[model samples]
Target: MAGYLTTHVLDTARGCPAQGIQIALYRVSGNSHKKIATAETNADGRTDAPILPEGKFAVGTYELIFFCGDYLRATGQTADDPLFLDQVPIRFGVSDGAAHYHVPLLLSPYGYSTYRGS
Candidate 1:
């Protein structure tokens, strides 16, 4: 079996896990995004488990939708006019599963960053 795709979101401005943030995993279909799974972050700012398990991992393109608007609002960190990028989408590819692929997002109300983690 191959590995899976997962992500953790951190509210960089608040310096904490982005708890209760809405998240969605989607696979890009022809012209639209196909929703696969929807979940929320826990107290630790991570999904309760791997977003996708070993047997479920696939070698293709994937996108993670993070609802920063709700996260910031819930955490009392929303900007004056909110952020233009309320929904941050990170599109990436999963080529191999033998290794663990952890993607972490460090985000703020106005900007965010993502990288391949352990």
Candidate 2:
């Protein structure tokens, strides 16, 4: 089977899925960054479809930027003028074109974490 890219965001501080967070996917080559896909998390904290679907799968470095600032303010999780953690970017590589890639974000008002999830 061919591979694709998927992701989700969980609001750790609120103990629930982070809805309406905007996410952008980009292909990174040296000093060049090209945006390839974008989506907003739904009520389930996930995009309705794969950010990078199978036909567009590639083997190289990529970045997923999670726009969390608005979500924080909407959910009343932040009161600072500028949040310590706002736009979270996770950079990773896909060496295999035939494997699934799941990058999930566990987030809070002050911190965030990610992993190669299934």
Candidate 3:
């Protein structure tokens, strides 16, 4: 199968899907990053489409920046000027170009966790 990338976000503290969170995908090379795609999470906490679709797939280092500040504030979770968990960046490498990648985030106002999902 052709490769692609998908993501999901959940507000662990609120026990609900993280909606309206902005997500940016970037191709990383050493110190350089080139943004390739952007998406917003729906009510289901998933992008309407794969963040990185098959035609645009590549094998290399990549970074996903999840914009959580707005969601936190909108949901009354923000408490300070600088959020402890704002733009959470997860950098990972894709070793195979023909495999699907699912990255999921379990998030709270102060912290977050990510893992490679099915």
Q: What residue pairs are clashing in model 2?
A: none
Best by lDDT: 2
**C-alpha lDDT (0 to 100) for residue 90 of candidate 1:** 91
**Which segments of candidate 2 are over 4 A away from where they belong?**
none
Ranking by TM-score: 2, 3, 1
Order of all candidates by lDDT, from best down to worst? 2, 3, 1
Q: Candidate 3: minimum summed lDDT over ten consecutive residues — where? A: 77-86
Residue-wise lDDT of candidate 1 within 9-43, one digit each (tens)? 98888888888888889988567888888888899
Per-residue lDDT over 70-106 for candidate 2, one digit per residue giving the tens place of the 0 to 100 score = 9999999889987888899999999999899999999
Model 2, backbone clash pairs (residues 3+ apart or across chains), number: 0
lDDT of model number 3: 0.94
- CA lDDT scores, all candidates in order: 0.82, 0.96, 0.94
Give the alpha carbon lDDT tens digit for every residue of 15-56 in model 3.
999999999999999999999999999999999999999989
Model 1 spans with C-alpha error above 4 angstroms: none
TM-score of each candidate structure, all chains considered together: 0.90, 0.98, 0.97
RMSD of each: 1.6, 0.5, 0.7
